[model samples]
Structures are given as structure tokens and as C-alpha cells.
Target: MNLTVARLTVRGLLGRRRGILLLVVPALLLVISVIGRSSGSDKHDLAVTILGELSLGTLVPILGLIVGTGVIATEIDDGSIVYLLAKPLPRWKIITTKLAIAVVTTWAFAAVPTLLAGLILYGTQDGLAVGFALGTVVAGAAYSAVFLLLGVVTRHAVVAGLGYALVWESLVGNYVQGAKTLSVQQWGLSVAKAVAADGAIPAHVSLAAAVPLLVVVTVAATAFASVKLAGLTLASDE
Candidate 1:
């Protein structure tokens, strides 16, 4: 990746109130986990609720949206991306650079806290903590790629990202069986369930299906975003 592009992406992602916003969700998760750990709540319930629903469902997607879009969408919207695109750099490198920053940021703010929350809630019993943590890592990376493509493809990147996460994944997926197959949350959940002692939690999609879907989605999104960015640069110059 380009160091210059990587530096600029990091600066943009962590600058202003954006960095603070990224911290809020993870901090909130850790706090809640600590409290839940002390309370009368059952460990299994706490782990599934906080790590599964809160971490995987809510925190991962939103962080992916903010970091992914914030990395490039803001620059694109402000027309500052022109200078970067005009540079004699490989388009894929630029995309990869920004993508690397987004993945790391999302992992730090989402996955790390998730692992902590899982451990606080359930320890290593039945592989609960590690399982969910692994799920978060993979899911966070996938979310970053998907949302990064949305950032390049839409002016309403955040709105679009939220709609897909909340409306499509959370809402529709719960009631619609077919929708769950296409959900990042469910895919992650499937991964988590696979790691934990048998039947520790529910998983809708099979491991075979979920793993491939997750890989395909991330790679496709990145490939498409790179192409779109190249096209945008060419169109702007015309």
C-alpha cells in the first residue's frame, strides 16, 4: 500500500469528532459487559446478547460504515479525492491503502472490544469468548469492504449502509428466512456457533455456505469499488 495514501486515510479517519464517535460504541460495550458480569444475569445470556446482538449486529456494521465511508466518501464529496486520483498511483493501491486503515480501525473499535466483552461475560468456557471474537474479526473485515464500496458508489453512503444493516439485515433477516442467508451478522453468528460447544448458540447458514459468502462478498466489493473509483477519476477528467 502507499504510505502517503495510508497516512492521509488515517488522518481523515481519526480526525475531528470522527475518532471520538468510533470510541463511543466500543467503550459502551465494555462498560455494559462489566456491569453485566457483576449482575445476576446468566453468562450464556449475557454473552449471546451483548457479543452476538450488540457487538456483531450493531457495533460492527456501524463502525464499518463510519470508517469505510469516512476514509474516502468525505474526500470524494469534498472533491479532495481528485488530487489523490490524479497522482501516478495504481488505483488498487489507493483502494487497498484506505481499505487497510478502515479494516484496522473497525477491528480496534469493534472486534477488540467484542473479545473483551465476550471474555467478561463468559470466559473461555465452551469457547464462547474466542468464538465471538473470531466472528467479529471476520465480520468486521467483510463489513469494511462492503461499506467501502457503498461509500464509492453512493453519495448517501452512511444512509445506505445503515439501511442495509438495520433494515435489511436486522429487521428483514429476522422474519425472512431467505434474508438471513445473505446477512453478514448471521454469517458471523454461524462462525461463532461453529467454534463454541455444540448448540451453544443458533446459526442459520451452514459453515460451508457462510464462509464462501463472506469471502466472495468482501473480495467482490473491493474489486468493484476499485473499478468505480477508476471510472470516477476518468469521468471527472473528461
Candidate 2:
């Protein structure tokens, strides 16, 4: 992919109204962190739960959905993607470049805020800061790839992504023990388990299962997004 094209796309995706929308998630986390810290109600489990569940599980995925799909689907919808597609760049390169940008942006916005939120809430106890940071990074990257693929393969990417992140993973996993095995939020909690001091954070899934699933989901999503972009078609305005 052309670096110039990627740079331009990144700048545009982050500029204007989209940037405000992207900031909403991290901003919400930080705001809640400030409020929680000031109220003198800070507790270890509460910190762990908030950073673990809300930051990793909810905010990261939402930001990923907005950023990942915003990067390409908006272009596709407005027909500007034709300009990029008409060029001589390899399709895989284009997809890879966009995916990379999405992943990095998601991490910056989601993971960094999570780290700061952790520090604000818990100070330096039980490796909570480190564990939650790592968890956010992994979850953010996976969310980027998954949502990027959604952007390429479907027009209703935001809706579908929200449904999966909110309804399927959050709702179903909460109710069904079997569903926890298949949840990304749970996979991220496993990473938290590895980073946290012993008995500090808890995870339902084991490290053995979570690691492979994280790698596979991220790599597979990236590969599938590349393939989809290679064969991507823009619908006619007719």
C-alpha cells in the first residue's frame, strides 16, 4: 500500500467529527476514573472490575468498532474508496496498512487511557496497572482486526459489531457458562490473570486457551480482512 494513501486516510479518519466520536470512549473512562478517585471510594476489586470489565470489555470494543469501520466503511459508502482501489497498490497491502493503522489507533486510544485510569484508581497495587494495560492492548488489537473485517465485509459494520460485543459477548457470556469459553472479554481476562500478582485478578478462562485464541483471532481476522479487501466491490449508486 502507498504510505501516502495510508497517512492521508489516517489523518482524515481522525480529523473532524470522527475524532470527537473516537474520543468519547477514552474520555468516558478517564472521567469515570476521576470521579471514582475523588469520591474516596477506590478499592482494589472495584478498580480491577472497572478496568477489567468496563475498559477492556466495553470501551475498547466500542472504540474499535468506531475506528475500524470508520477507516474504510465511510470511504466505501461515499465511493471515495474507488480512488484508492484504482491505484496500482496490491490489495493485501492496502488492507494490511489500514488494519495496522486501525490496531495502533485503537491501542493508543483505548489501552493508554486504561493504563492511566488504572493509575488513577488503584495507585500501584497487585500489579493491577500492568495486568490491565496488557489486557487492554490484546483486546484492542483483536477488536481492531475483527471490526476492520466487519467494515470490509458488511455495510452495517457498526451495528453488527455492537451486537457482537454487547449482546453476544457481554449478555450471553454473563448468563451462560458455556458462552464464557468463546468470549473475547474472557480471553482478555486471562491475560490480566497472567500479568496481575497472584490472587489479585481472576479469570474464568485459562492462560493456555486464551493465548492461542487471542493470536488466532487477531491473525485470522487480519488475513480474512485482507482477502475481503482484495475482492471488495463497491455497490453502484443506481
The numbered model that scores best in TM-score is 1
TM-score of each: 0.97, 0.93
TM-score of 1: 0.97
CA displacement after TM-score superposition, residue 126 of candidate 1 (Å):
1.1
lDDT of 1 by residue, 1-238 (tens): 8999999889888996998899999999999999999999788987888888899999999999999899999999999999999899988889888899999999889888988898888888888888888888889989999999999999999999999989987788766998999999989998988998897877889999999999999999999999999999889999
Worst 10 residues of 1 by lDDT: 168-177
Residue clash pairs of candidate 1: none
Candidate 2 ranges with C-alpha deviation above 4 Å: 40-42, 233-238
Cα distance off (Å), candidate 1, residue 176: 1.5
With a 3 Å backbone cut-off (N, CA, C), the pairs that clash in candidate 2 are none
Look at candidate 1 and tell me the lDDT of residue 69.
Answer: 90
Per-residue lDDT, model 1, residue 196, is 88
Q: Which 10-residue span in candidate 2 carries the lowest summed lDDT?
A: 229-238
The lDDT of each candidate is 0.90, 0.84
